[model samples]
Target: MVNKLPLSGETVIFTSTKKSEEPYELVRQLGGNPVSYPLIRTEERVSVNDDERMMQTRNYDWLIFTSQSAVAAFHHKLKRFKMDVQDYELRVAAVGEKTAHALERIGFRVDFIPDVFSADVFVRQFNPEGESLRALFIKGNLAGTLISTELSLSVDEWTVYETLPEVSSAARIVELVKDTTSVTVLFASPSAVTVFTEHVAPKIGWAGYTIGAIGHITKRALHRMGAPVHVMPETYTLPELVQTLAGSKGRN
Candidate 1:
């Protein structure tokens, strides 16, 4: 039906392997097009070596989780330590509602959750006024500087997850961009946008496509790569992105 394929002529690529049908449906409703092209691939960077050490202590003042993946990976590592949920006594703080929800499902009480779900916001909420609190940050290896700069607290970071490039997908994307007359690439993260543009720059050359970023950070990444980001949402969320595209249906 015409209603289901509102995005019939438009071909947009999603960055994650995970499928977000809401955006596709929204694009279809607006007579645009949508496609899936995962840029970054996720893999657990956890190991038994780190788990063996973490299990020996309960001195951390807080356990901070940045992403849902970090929470999941951290829990997965805990399973190898042969420990129950009672092993951790520290206060828990999470970056986003979704991350907090993941921790809550595992029966850990989250003590602090910031209003906004950005690195800068999370940093601002952390206390510099308190005594030196030993905080443990569970995040990706390539995390932003907020954790170190904001807290001024004694902190340790572990790379529970690593975001690597999908080399094959990147090539396919380049081919897709080169073959198509026009395309619109949706970028949700600065990292994804950076890697995407860097690899496709020489080949695609932006002849028939425009870049779309989720927010200012991602938009900035696009700029650093010398790629112009045309569509940016006022608020950052998957649903917001869908609505933004739905409002402007004429893009090819």
Candidate 2:
């Protein structure tokens, strides 16, 4: 028999620019009304107008991918730049499991994966030694500085993808919250939190709402925007955040 989740009747909003399916389904399985609103728009950076220098060579020691979006954007660039995925002879290091999975989907093998998903932790344990250990990271405009300064290897990061505010989804988010009472909004990244403020404008009407942040940076953004964090989970995973919020609601 299937178990019932405790979050029945609760409405939780998710912010993911890439139209995530798994996380949203997980939320629905838990009996929560999960709504996804993409906050950032992404596009491939490689183009006819792109710098010839940037597209010149794919030789690198390691290819680091931080998010699944980076993976998607990188592959798109590969198609446009006429890059041979096999031409780049380098090890793969991914910060998150999802990112690694995305690469795997494209038949790429990742050699270095850490237990923790955070960029800071990945840098600490990364052992990018050897002559072919120099690294190149395919990342977004809002990537953290950890990539450019890999503690173990010579690292360089290129903004292969850029993120912009998704105004339409943002506006729809505001509309959802306007009708729903006491909604719990989940911010997955700093960009999501940053865009939320502008997209929603006067806020998500936290008058009867709660906020949930996926990470520390997102927490800071919500507080900066005057949203009270009713629940900040110990972990940043989607399941953990949902469980934490549901548990907190029951406790109160």
lDDT of each structure? 0.73, 0.74
- Write down the TM-score for model 2: 0.85
Report how far off residue 20 is in candidate 1 (Å). 6.0
Residue-wise C-alpha lDDT for candidate 2, range 59-115, written one tens digit per residue: 676788888888887777667667767776667888766788889987689998876
lDDT of 1 by residue, 192-234 (tens): 7756766766677755776677767777887887778777767
Lowest lDDT 10-residue stretch of candidate 2? 49-58
lDDT of 1 at 76: 77
Q: Judged by lDDT against the true structure, how good is candidate 2?
A: 0.74
Mark the regions of model 2 whose C-alpha exceeds 4 Å error after superposition: 1-3, 49-57, 81-84, 201-207, 232-235, 250-252
**Which residue pairs does candidate 2 place in steric collision?**
none
Name the regions of candidate 1 deviating beyond 4 angstroms: 1-8, 17-33, 56-58, 128-130, 179-182, 250-252
